[model samples]
Target chain A: MSSRLSLRGFLALSALRTVNSLSRGTGRGSGTVAGGRVGLAIYPKLLNDLSKNRQVILVSGTNGKTTTTALCVAGWGDKVCSNATGANMPAGHVAALSGSSSPHVVLETDEAWLPVALEATNPRVVVLLNLSRDQLDRATEVRSIAERWRSALSKTAHDLVVVANANDPLVVYASESAKNIRWCNIETPWTSDAVSCPKCTQSIVRTSGSWSCVCGFTKPGCVASVSGSEVRIDNETVQTSLSIPGQFNVGNAAMAATALDVLNVDPSKSLTSMKSVTAIAGRFAVRTWQGRKIHMLLAKNPAGFDALLQSLSPGTDDVWIAINARIADGKDPSWLYDVSFEQLRGRKVWCLGERRLDLSTRLDYANVTYEVVNDLNSLPKTSDTTELLANYTAFSDWMQRTTA
Target chain B: MKIALIYPELLGTYGDYGNALALSQRSTRRGIDVDVMNVSITDELPDADLYLLGGGEDGPQRLAADLLKKSSLKQRVANGAHVFAVCAGLQILGTSFCVEGNDAYEGLSLVDVETTRGSVRSVGELLSQVGENKMVGFENHGGVTTLSPGIEPLGTVLHGRGNNGHFDGFVTETIWATYAHGPVLAMNPWLCDEVIAKVTGNNLTPLKTAADQLYAERVTSLSSR
Candidate 1:
């Protein structure tokens, strides 16, 4: 601990620790944000102070931040502190750092809070996964977020290493001005948001594996690339065998490996560490519910849903799609139309959620037959394993209910 | 009945494509044979009895407006095509629309209205009353439109900031434009039926489904809120 802390800062930290213990005893919630808010209210710069003498690594983007952060922490081996339960704002960072005395920390940051978190932690490595439209009601335009990121990264004094996705135009455009960058060719299946270049507003030209624009912007030369289950970094090729299913997870693991590489970690040990991570924050977990096997998936935006759709096994048909329009999930449910629910054309889909009607409406247009079940508990019991894909609040609620 | 979805690539933001889907599903339920055509900006405008346009960002909205102006859309609308346009789509069908921090762009001039940026963005649940029916949906836009004299609105704003924080939408004999973009038609089935009745020139039987119950509940909840 830093001895230069003011008396007020010390008092705030003690209060936060007591509040966190009391909240956990009450068993209301994770107590991460609750304790964090208390601490931050007393000292607004608590995160900066807590993060001092710590080598922080921030993972931020529209999606996959949690999984990537988990993977990065695993690659860093034991004694790595992280916000493991998905409480990822500045308050969450304070709560996470306040608990552990580890000098190394990995954090998953929200998209809009990336600049603020970056300034506070001054991380040695910033891993940016990809940028896409998400929660338009709560978030500003995607281009505006990227512009802010570019402005923030350009002014940093330290030699910050940026692990960026080259395939996403927004990510590429935002991190292009960084001095030291480790680009990853992380393929994005959903290209609707990247149709126009963020810099020039012209249609981007995309080939099979690369994308370019009429202006001077294009996919940067990637030092790390993911091909199927294999990751290529420098001259070493490591076949990732993660318990998590999906190419997106593989891309996330590749980014983790590259981040570890920048920290001079052994490649074999990093890959070994990643293979042990079966689930992160309740995602990609196979659980038995009411004697029926179920696979839980979380998709917040069109790009995430598209990737989840592609990850489905060929013979798998039955699906349950739940959507909600809560403040956490964005009050507007219009993004439902942007998803290609047509991919579920022949599958038996059971739409259930606060906004199941919107999902059913989108499914109807996709020419898919669906049954709307208002009560999730009344869903018909099936012998076979079923896939459950839901948005943010729905997924969180389901996880809480099922686990409880 | 043929319905052409115009510039979906550029104008299909905010789930506006749901409007087209709503039309097709309702038409199929009514035993009416509906042929839906998706027309891109580069493609020639297809002649249809009804046309659908969705909302989009400012740049794509301008591109869609420019393309529609140059294409045969104006001619077809002049020839009595029933057109339903949402947020950006509504702005694009008007005479002119001013973007924030940019010069104003020319619209298709198919509707007797003009659009300007509002002082603040209007984003929330919008409830409008059109005749005996109430339409409920989500509205997220900064554009405030003013209609010319002799032109009537689609409905009266019950809640939320409608066009210029007062009226809801503009409606003429063959054109209807609104900012209520909860895939407006899906949440407002009566408006969907109205569009179909205007385009097909027939009073179709009402077909109710589980979706209706959801819509009714949502309307009640939104109105109460």
Candidate 2:
């Protein structure tokens, strides 16, 4: 068969297959396929074709992958052919590539799946969100993963655009291979455990809520940067002016905008788009339940969870921490110890999930006060306006029902 | 006391260090000083009152087990010293770890559990109802560990699991290993205290401060089933 005919035929088959897969996987009890796999298979070829006209941007992290991906895609508008659905894995990228019609693909690649997905998508630009200790049972060690990413970035010939989280030393070293790296950070006052430098393994000092590495390798105010508050995306400084409010979101938005700029998109347009996108389903999503404002932030790992806890202010009328014993939430919930729940002062937490008791006991040992609720259905029905900070599946179901 | 936190280089999963932290905190509370050492394949193992091992990915666990075999650590385990192993660390504490496709690697046999990589990987919050009480924690082990007879399983299975398919704390005299990943000691302060009691045989009083009182009040309010 001729190459052109084969390409057309392949696209057609992939599109059909994806539709079928999505339908099958849409049901609640269906296994993990969501048209993400086949979509990943088609990404490399489709993205390579766009190389003549535009650059590819790949976003991956334990959290914020979706928000950043959306920001970049919305920023590019007509210029980008993206899967901004927050699917960072291989299949998710393929699905996005297959659906997009633009020249550029703004893809979200999973950290665990980055090596395979990169080989498949081969995007020109890679944006790494902060590296946190997440799913220790399945994912590679943070340092090892970073080292692999550094090696992978070294090999990619594409005009490498490294969008980094400056507060995270691990991510800085991960994207070390990309010489054209632009650092982004969260300048918010929500200070937590992200204070170490990845290079010299030295402590980064935070002055007036803004952190600066004393390593001298980072240029003052120029090389090392901040989130929406300090980093200039388009021309505006990165800040919480966007739809998302968590301290991490500012960094995510900044990184997204930076990636767009690297892709030759006008920084102004990117910033404009950045303001329009909000939180993804699990990452700090807000939903109204029976006239009460329910804030939901997916706390997958200790870092993300720590950020969520740090981002949490003193005035949560009621807090519900929903933990799942599912594999996706880390087969072992032992990492919860690292989470400084001590910050959650005054507000009583409604601990609910298969792991509710587990969390409750941990809170008990830490002397954190919490109430245990086993039923997820009663999450909204319960009084005191509970904030359902649930896991992947539980949160998704809760959102769908509450919204519907 | 210097606590040799084995596999810190590979098995660190945030609060994974909390096991050490809790150990350190409780030890300090009882007027015991601890220097928690992070020893990996690259670093030499240190001496301590306790040797701890936590969970990580299969690759790292295998790598750590291989590295531990080459060290001068056997003398420590044989001396009836305190060793706290969780999940992957527990598996490595066995006579041999049978990971699929790989030959069963010899273990320290600090415990009676025999671990082999299983087709089914267990992950989630582990709640085991042991001895009339439910022990709450997390267990994300990819390998299935079977405890030998005469060994007491750690905790009761309230949700996720217990030791050797049993929802109880697996106890083998001086050695203690379990799938309790919730950094093991963070939620189970009693367990930490018990380990300390066994290791040192010191009647250290555990204080429940205003923090503990507040926690009880909150749980009482929230756990209204």
| Interface RMSD per candidate (angstroms) | 2.2, 6.5
> Can you give the DockQ of every candidate in the order shown?
0.50, 0.25
Candidate with top lDDT is 1
Tens-place lDDT per residue, model 1, A1-404, is 65625677788887887798777453433336788889889988888888887788999999899999989888999899899978889998888888777888899998889899988888989999988889888788677888889988887765789999988888988898788899998877877777766776666888989888778788888899989999989889998889898999999999999988988887668977998898777789877777777788999998899999888987647898889999999999888877888888778899978888878867766778898886767787988778999999999877876652
Candidate 2: tens digits of C-alpha lDDT, residues B153-180: 7665656645546554466666777777
Chain A TM-scores, one per candidate?
0.95, 0.80
- The runs of at least 3 residues in candidate 2 whose Cα sits more than 4 Å from the true structure, single-residue gaps closed, are A1-54, A77-80, A178-180, A185-224, A232-240, A282-285, A375-386, B1-11, B17-53, B56-81, B87-174, B179-182, B185-225
Fraction of true contacts reproduced, model 1? 0.47
Clashing pairs in 1: none
Full-model lDDT for every candidate: 0.84, 0.63
Per-residue lDDT value at B212 in model 1: 76
State candidate 1's TM-score. Answer: 0.92
Weakest ten-residue segment in model 1 chain A by summed lDDT: A24-33
